[model samples]
Target chain A: MNYEVHNWGLNVGNVEITGVASSSIFLIGDNETIKLTSFYDTPPDSYIVGSLVPLRHPTIEEGTDNG
Target chain B: MDKRVAHIGKTRINSIAYSSMFEIGDANTFTPTSRVIAVQKEGGVETDEGFEFDQYELFSQEPSNVPDSLTVQQKNYHHNPNIHVENIDVKGISASSIAQLGSLNHIDSVSRIKHIRILEKEQNQNDLIE
Candidate 1:
């Protein structure tokens, strides 16, 4: 699946992909303008487009890793 | 030290160098110099310490009710009861920035940024997946 990423802080170095139940992959980041592709069993890949920053997208799951 | 007694409503007022004390019959409002750690409403609305409001209803109802100086987390469990929020990490974020983020409709984790540097080399997919 392809998703638009945005509203992440510039401090985020890179996004980390994690596989949930059954072959669901999630792409997580703080903020930026990028296009990402998530594969069922494979890790996601992202490409930063020009300087077109997008709005916040619903991708990062709540309280999944931050402990 | 100065002490004044008012017969209007049996109120006693005492003032010393730095602080002032008030004893009134009716309600009393106090303004703190620092941030408020917690808030408890009359009808079972109890926010935890560190300005954390556990009641998702309050946030869903009126997100603006939350103080700007405090940090907060809003989960849409009421709208999507079956949704399970595993984790959300937001740190080092300023109050103004959080307000700009607006509604956290489907977000799970968030963190504040301290610096930014473009990656010269492309990231490998295998390295990102865990």
Candidate 2:
């Protein structure tokens, strides 16, 4: 009997992957003036983000529901 | 002739006496005198004129009664892109192996890894107001 052994096999494992995923950023600025009157009146629950200057008549009331 | 002469002499003597007496009386009694006086007075008058004013009454009513003349100022804001990392993952994996048989069993292995990255950003901003 011939005493000879041949081991032929292939094994592959342990893989590593790396990457960089970045995004761009943007910043915006705004400045504005608003006017309130009888016809185009401001809402009662309006969110004010900047300076607000309101010009109102003496006889007229603010935030009155005319509907 | 004697009577005519006597009459003429008597008439002349009478005329001469009358003329002399009248001249003496006029020169003695006729003295001229004159006097004058003046007065002045002032007066004033005043008048009153009528005045008229048209009184206007202004009343406050409901907003529906008033005319719609008010306007609203609208502002259009600029847009900016907001970017951020969306996803990061391994795309694929590849592996290969070689077998060598000289005296003992030997195996050599190699692997090639791939990766993928994704980025996302905002194209427009949301509506701020109605």
Candidate 3:
């Protein structure tokens, strides 16, 4: 698959992915920030790749399920 | 109402508090220096990186009540294309830093469907007609 994002994707614990093609990387928390460079052939190819590393909020229990 | 009486002296209020009271500098002086992650500022200082989790936790029972104007996601896209983020070094960033960023009112949502495999199985099942 060209693009694949697994579970808890966006804003899930500061994990970031960067780069393109084989050069891309998945940066976990405490990892280095990844920067990408543009390719001349594909003018629009230049872009950073990653979702916002979200801070996981503790699960909130419903006082009344209403079920 | 005598101009001469008022012109007795032009005493300059040099104190920092006085300077802040008037529109001497940017009005930002009255606002806290903590940079809410999404908010912009004149200075290059990281404004949004200053909120600690303890300060910005949204679901806390007592103090963590959601703000009256909390940001919400208006659109939900499932398993959509991914967008890249810059200026964040995983090693350089901390959970607290992320918490600070969350304090800023931005809706970041990831839309994905669950139980797809189970749903597919259910779709294939059929009851034989009597």
Candidate 4:
């Protein structure tokens, strides 16, 4: 395979982002590879009336590896 | 990638995650993993078989919902990137996330989160009585 190379002036004005969350990334220069995985389970039945959420405590053994 | 002058007027990041990264130059590899499981109900959701950390599950088996891209897999990737930016503003980086300003070689991130909320319109359950 044959490839040609060209270099040109790269310019940008402004960048605005609200959030980079939950295993997300914000890069500014250059990268080779990026792999991001996210799993969200917010059931519709769970979201009710108000904005309050009563979190539960997981019941695990003392010696269990909670990694 | 070509080398050139990189300029930025301002950069602001509100927050970073408990397990996250913020780099300014360059990185070889980045691998971050996050796992979160939540359940809310009178007791709990039940089925014939339970789920595990190393396994995959769903409340109901829906083929369209859970796609193949979301599934865990091992693959190879290649990239050729270059950028010039100014005034970057980010809100937050959470759940094993990364924020870079220069250049990166490779990045692999994983996040597993599960949230289930089950509540009645009227609050009924209590600690001492129902």
Better of 1 and 4 by TM-score: 4
Question: Please, what are the lDDT tens digits per residue for candidate 1 over residues A6-37?
Answer: 22222223222221211111222112222211
lDDT for each residue of candidate 2 in A1-67, tens digit (9 for 90 to 100): 2233222222223222231111100111111221111211222224447634443435657787634
Q: Could you tell me the lDDT of residue B42 within candidate 3?
A: 37
For residues B1-130, could you state the per-residue lDDT of candidate 3 as single tens digits? 0000001111122222111121211111111111112222334434434445445333232322444654443433334233223333222211111212111222121111111011213221123211
DockQ, candidate 4, comes to 0.27
How do the candidates rank by TM-score, highest first? 4, 3, 1, 2
Better of 1 and 3 by TM-score: 3
Q: lDDT tens string, model 2, B14-53?
A: 1111101111000112111111111111232222122111
The iRMS of model 3 comes to 23.9
TM-score of chain A of each: 0.16, 0.13, 0.21, 0.51
The true-versus-predicted C-alpha distance at residue B18 of model 4, in Å, is: 3.6
Better of 1 and 2 by DockQ: 1
- The TM-scores of all predictions, comma-separated, are 0.13, 0.11, 0.14, 0.58
Chain B TM-score, structure 2: 0.14
Q: Tens digit of lDDT per residue, candidate 4, span B9-122? A: 678888786578877776678999877666566666675244455454632222244344443343322222335676788877888888887767788887767775655555
Which is the winner by TM-score between candidate 2 and candidate 3?
3
**Rank ordering of all candidates by lDDT, starting from the highest:** 4, 1, 3, 2
Position B21, candidate 1: lDDT: 19
What's the residue-level lDDT of B98 in candidate 4?
A: 88
